[model samples]
Target: MDWDREARTGLPEAVFCAGKTPAQIDAILAEARAAGRRVLLTRLDPARRDALAAKEGLDYDAASATAILGGPAPARPGRIAIVTGGLADLPAATEALRTLAFCGFAGELVADVGVAGLWRLLERIDAIREVDVVIAVAGMEGAIFSVLAGLVTAPIIALPVSFGSGVSAGGRLALDAALGSCAPGLVAVNIDNGFGAAQAAIRMLSPRGGTAQNAGPS
Candidate 1:
């Protein structure tokens, strides 16, 4: 479980629940409890979440398929803005938001602002610009990532969502676009990896002194 990870890297170990059986998850949770640790669980589907419903202090969000054990830590010092290209991208954006919350950071969601309707994003530009970091979630051509990067001074973390048809299927098109973006200094994580994007933002916002308080939940 890498119990010292928060002390070593300013980031605690998180459990990825996908492909894990109920018994295995129970064991992991039991171990965490025994160690007096707080843990975040990602990719926990509704069925699996239901299976673990008896777990004490389990805070589950079905939309993002994420769960928190031992509750979230106190809020940290950082402002994050999660922008989605469209309503279809909300799941990925929600994951990022949940990750930030679990890590004791506050973030806001700016939804349905795809370039297809540029006015939507333009109207909300002011609010988004106020954040320390921006997470852009999009599918299809993923023009939103580049557009937001160009518009905002904050670091842009492109999170490609798997929501589209044809060439955009499986989020590959959006992933390629993010990787190939002409926007200077724009960074990208794996397709649909909202948790990774949140962690990256946390690292960017973490105190330079490497204090354990800034490290995510213990």
Candidate 2:
């Protein structure tokens, strides 16, 4: 664990569980409990989640592939929005949602609103605009980020997911398009990094003026 991460950086420590063994994850969880620290474990598999569920104080969300130790912070209205291009994008969207939940922020989801059917997204324009920040999750061309940027004044956090298919090449094109977007108030995070997107939104909505100097909520 990064002891100074919360105080110095204003972010909690999280475990990446994709490559770690069950025993290793358990050890980390034990450490977190021992230190009275809240931790999030990302990319966790269902088997591991189930196995660890027996442990005291561990909650797991299968859709997001995330597990929480020491309970999530209480959720409050934070005026955050999460929109996805298609159903295939829900996995990524779920990750952001779980992260937001852990940080005590509430968010709404606008699903299956890809640019191909612009009308779907157009229908939700007014609702999306009411939020302080928008998280656009897409995988194919990642055009949603730029499109949303042109419409909403709220800052957009572009989150790209990997399709693992031809040409798309695990979301490289989407990532590239998001980074090169011409629209204002659009920021891009790493491909499939839903947690990163959530953290960015939390910072943007932070009353502390979006600087690490102001520590986040406990």
Q: What is the TM-score of each candidate against the true structure?
A: 0.94, 0.90
lDDT (tens digit, per residue) of candidate 1 on 146-201:
99999989999999999999999999999999999999999999999999999999
Worst 10 residues of 2 by lDDT: 209-218
Model 1 lDDT at residue 86: 92
Compared with the true structure, what per-residue lDDT tens digits does model 2 show for residues 105-151?
Answer: 87799999999999999999999999989999999889999999999
Segments of candidate 1 deviating more than 4 angstroms: 212-218
Residue ranges of candidate 2 with Cα displaced over 4 Å: 50-54, 209-218
Top candidate (lDDT): 1
Please state every model's RMSD to the true fold in angstroms: 2.8, 3.0
Q: Cα lDDT for residue 16, model 1?
A: 91
Clashing pairs in 1: none
Error of 1 at 7 (Å): 0.8
Q: Count the backbone clashes (under 3 Å) in each candidate.
A: 0, 0
Residue 174 shift from truth in candidate 2, angstroms: 0.7
Q: Kindly provide the TM-score of model 1 when superposed on the true structure, using C-alpha atoms.
A: 0.94
